[model samples]
Target: MIKNIQRTLIELANIHRFVMRFYREVFMPPYEFKEIIRQCYVVGWKSLPLISLTGFITGVVFTNQSRPSLAEFGATSWLPALISIAIIRALAPLVTALIASGKVGSQIGAELGSMKVTEQIDAMEVSGTNPFKFLVVSRVLATTISIPILSFYTAAVGLFGAFLSVNQNENTSFRVYFDQVFDAVTFLDMFSLVLKAVVFGFTIGIVGCYQGYHSSKGTEGVGRAANWAVVMSMFLVFVEEILIVQIIQAMRA
Candidate 1:
């Protein structure tokens, strides 16, 4: 048990060093704008359909589930505001991050792990290419930039789904429902959403890269890298969510 704990601490220290190196390298030289753009397209655009479907379903199901309790208290009219607060401040960002951890995070780990095992990354190094910058920095920056926008999109889609559910039950008009949503959502809520999205994105990207870049030397290692990336990213995301929520609540109080 003690050995396992020590190994975990050592791994965490290595990760911290890796992150620090990323910061040092990211701002120092020839920017890989094209690579970053390509990664953004892959990470953001390709994930949209899944995000949209998930967000819509989540909103619909949550609204439906909550309707009964609200109806019991004759507070059914508060549905739009309630849905808006829940989705914008928490659900949209958290769900989007979790999905990305599973999808994008695993892909990144597998791709990099393959490159590592095949000596592709080493070849790039020998060829005088800054593989870390071209690959790691670009992908990390792509996730950081894409996630907040995706979170916003998720929130919008979710609200629309909630509106549909509410309209079917209460006959609320689109404009009225949206107005109520906006009215209930504050600047703090928007701030929290963006902040959470960016942090989660960074965590996912960095953890995936770290795992894959340092994967063991085997085909089996590639699979392990991808699995570890997903698991670690999700774990860190939840930890960040809890910490950020606590901080935000303290600020609000």
Candidate 2:
């Protein structure tokens, strides 16, 4: 157990160094605009359908589950406001990031790990092409930008789904439901959620790229990289969520 703990600590230290290197390289000259755009398209556009579906189901399920308890307390009318706050402040960002970790994170790891094992990365180095810039930076940037947009999309779709669910059980009008929801949502709520999304996005991208870029020399390593990418990204998302919540609370106090 001690050995395992030591190994984990070493790996974390290495990851910190990798993050520092990424920050340095990302801001250096010769920005890869086209590559970044392509990655954004792949990460954002391709992930939308899945995000929408997940958010809709989450809203429907959450509404259904909470409705009974609220009804018991004669507070069913509070559904919209409750659901909106939950989704915006936590559910949408967390769920969306987890999905992206499994989808985009795994894809990044597998792609880069395969390249590593096949000597493609080495070939790029030999050919004087900056593989790190072309691959890692672009992907990280794409994820950073895409996640916030996806969070907004998820919140919107989730509210829509909540509307549908609420209408089925009650006679709440759309405008009134939203007025209740939006009235409760402060600018702090939106800003904090977006900030969380950005952090989650960065964690996913950096973890995925780090795993893939440093993959061992075998096909099995590619699978391991993908697995690690998803696992680490998800873990970091939860950790980040806790930290952000504490920070927000402290700020409020």
Candidate 3:
């Protein structure tokens, strides 16, 4: 078990290095700037609506579930502040990471894997086109830029949803709720959480693309890449969450 873990860690480190190298290559000569913009449109704006809707619902459900627990302790009045902190610091980014891993990560893996199996990757090379630059970097950059913005949008919608949920059993204005939320949440909290989301998004895109581009087991390889991308991204996001929390705590101290 220890050996397996060690080997896997080494493999992951190598893959991360490869992703970085490809990113640098993409920026050098004959830039594929168009693809990057297209991907941003596809990954960002197209993803916003769904992410926002889900984020709102997640906030509502989270508030509803936690509200009763706090109310049992005679702390219903604390709902807005607590919910805001929860959404801003943890829930929005974490949940969005999971959703994006499953959605965009799998899509990237499958698309790249399919292209590889079809010999299109070889064609790109034959035509003197850097496939990794045009395809992988574009998508990866899109995800990196998009996820944080989506996370912010999600946070706003989520807070709004929490506001509405609070009104279901009590009377709380949006202004009052947001004020309390901002009061409890520090700038560090925003920076840390959003930074973590950006990292998570980059990991999801790059890892997914890596797995897909390198897969070689025929049709089975494509499926494997998608599966691994989702799993790897989720695990990495969880690990990062722990590391980020520690960093935040250390910074506060």
TM-score for predicted model 1 compared with the true structure: 0.98
Question: Which candidate wins on lDDT?
Answer: 1
lDDT for 163 in candidate 3 is 89
TM-scores, each model vs. reference: 0.98, 0.96, 0.92
lDDT of each: 0.95, 0.93, 0.87
lDDT of 2 by residue, 38-133 (tens): 999999999999999999999999999999999999999999999999999999899989999999999999999999999999999999998988
Model 2 misplaced regions, further than 4 Å: 1-6
Candidates ranked, most accurate by TM-score first: 1, 2, 3
Order of all candidates by lDDT, from best down to worst?
A: 1, 2, 3
**Candidate 1 lDDT over residue span 198-227, tens digit each:** 999999899889889998899999999999
TM-score of 2: 0.96
**Model 1 misplaced regions, further than 4 Å:** none
Q: Model 3, clash count?
A: 0
